[model samples]
Target: MTPPRVLAVAGSDSCAGAGLQADLKTLASLGCYGMTAVTAVTAQNTRGVSRVMPVPPDMVRAQMEAVLEDIGADAVKIGMLGSPENAEAVGEILGTLKGVPVVLDPVMAAQSGDGLNAEETPRALLAHVMPRVTVMTPNIPEAEKLTGLVVASLDGMEAAARRLVAMGCSNVLLKGGHFGGHDCPDLLFEGETGQLTRFAAPRIETRNDHGTGCTLASALAAYLARGLSLCEAARQAKTYTSGALQGAVSQQLGSGHGPLAHFHSGLL
Candidate 1:
């Protein structure tokens, strides 16, 4: 059988720990053929992002068109858009996909606490991207920024998920890793059915957590492309991500936050 095809619209990470690199790794590891439309190029390592050059919106669109118009995509994963214009560009593409599932990872900051998007980027995502997203994945800080709600607890995550659904997203995946507990839980709210599902996994203590959000979002897209239901896709993605995190526990990489072992399912 042909491999699932997934397009990753994100930035490029120099260190390969996050952004397009991580997205590609996750998608490939999950048996998906990955393509990319880089929104920005960042000089970043596990320590931090030093500089970022936003790709022109027209060029970003051109890249997406070149791949999507030719090969097409079974699913799409959108991450750090860098600029509001680029966000709109991605939204325009979403309008044409029809039924293809889109996993949007609202990547606002790096694991090293460096801001990745512009001030206007969030507004653009809310206005242009949210309504088209099949599964919108936002970490605690991102959910707070998008919903203006304190997402410090499980209840807060529930409220924030509802707010995101109200804001036009088809579904919301509120990632609770930033809540800092013994168990990290993610809440998925399906807008159509009003069903909320909670996925829990023990938090692995490791500095190699960089790119986790990108990895999870990409894995979700891969699973969706492979014909899994939303809930099942989320479950499998979480399991894959947990294993990746666990596999990286002994890895000694950069001085700061490193990356997850994306190929943990097989290679050791």
Candidate 2:
């Protein structure tokens, strides 16, 4: 029997913490068949990112087309595009394919505070990638970068989310992970229905929250690949991520912001 397929277009993490590694782990844990089009290769560990060598834009396009044209994807999760060209190329490819679930993570930095995208990459993504994004999950800083707004409070997050939806994303999940709060308030805004839902999970006190952004977005894509609605997918994805963070409390992985145990179910 053929399983639902989720294609992850992202960079490769040498620590196997985030990027392609996190994406694949999340997809598999959620019971979806996973495929990939690696955009960049990073030489680093859980502590911080040291070097990032991007795959050529043409090669990135080739990898995407090869998997998409043949194996086909039920959903796609786009993480860090190494450059403006890479972002535009991916956007161009997805624009041609209609009715596929695409979750754009809009990654900007590593958990240990290393830059991911170039200065112009966000603008390029806004121009090219936003229109194709079914659901965009951006943390506070990313939202601020994308919208040019000061995202410091829940009200600010809501306003930023509305702005993101107006930019062409079908839905926006504004993650509140950058700040310290008892409840991590995530706001979801639906473009079609204008319905908003809030997912507030208690902040798991652990530095092992690395790769969570990638993990959450990939989980959303996986659930969508399995034929779940956007709301349900978001719901499940949040639960999955929360569980990983909770499990990380007991984990002994890396020195700095360690990776979450995506396979917590199996680990237990």
Candidate 3:
């Protein structure tokens, strides 16, 4: 049997922890074949993103067309579109590829606190991409940015999720890491059904969580590619990420935030 195919449209993180690299690793780990259309290149390590150069819009669109026209994708995961143009390019491709599930991670800020997208990119995403997405995964800050609402508590996160649904997203996963609590809570709002589901896991005490958002979003896309429901995909992704974080706690690779153990399941 052939593995599910997932197309990841995102930026490249040279350290391989987040962005396109992390998405590829997560998809592969979750039993999916990964392909990519890189929107930007970043000089980054586990420590931080030092520099970034965005790929031209034409080149970005060409990569997407080449992959989708040939291999085709069961699912698509989008992240870190460096500019409004890049976001629109990705959105145009999404519009063309009908019936494929799209999981979008609105990655505005990096784990190292670097801004990845321009101020106009978020608005462009709302205008062009959000309506077409099957699911959107955003950390609290990103959610707040997208919705212009404060997410200081779990209730606030839920409100933000609903607002995002109003903004035309089919579903929203509001990640609760920025709440700064002992337990990390994530809220999943199903736009079509008006159902809200919550997933909570103990926050792992580790500094090596640089690519966690990308990992989760990619894992969700991988599971969707394998024909799992959105809720089931999110559940499996949370468990997978928790294990990766715990397994990599002791192996520090960079001076700042480090990479999760992408190969943890193999080591077991």
- Judge candidate 2 at residue 93 and give its lDDT: 94
Q: Which model scores highest in lDDT?
A: 1
- Give TM-scores for every candidate, taking all chains together and pairing residue i with residue i: 0.98, 0.97, 0.98
Q: Poorest 10 consecutive residues of model 2 by lDDT?
A: 259-268
Identify the superior model by lDDT, candidate 1 or candidate 2: 1
Q: Candidate 2 clashing pairs? A: none
Model 3 agreement with the true structure over 238-258: per-residue lDDT tens digits: 888888888789986988899
Q: What overall lDDT goes with each candidate model?
A: 0.93, 0.90, 0.90
For model 1, how does the per-residue alpha-carbon lDDT over 63-146 read when each residue is reduced to its tens digit? 999999899999999999999999999899888888899999999999999999999999999998889989999999999998
Error of 2 at 112 (Å): 1.0
Ordered from best to worst TM-score, the candidate numbers read: 1, 3, 2
Off by over 4 Å in 3: none
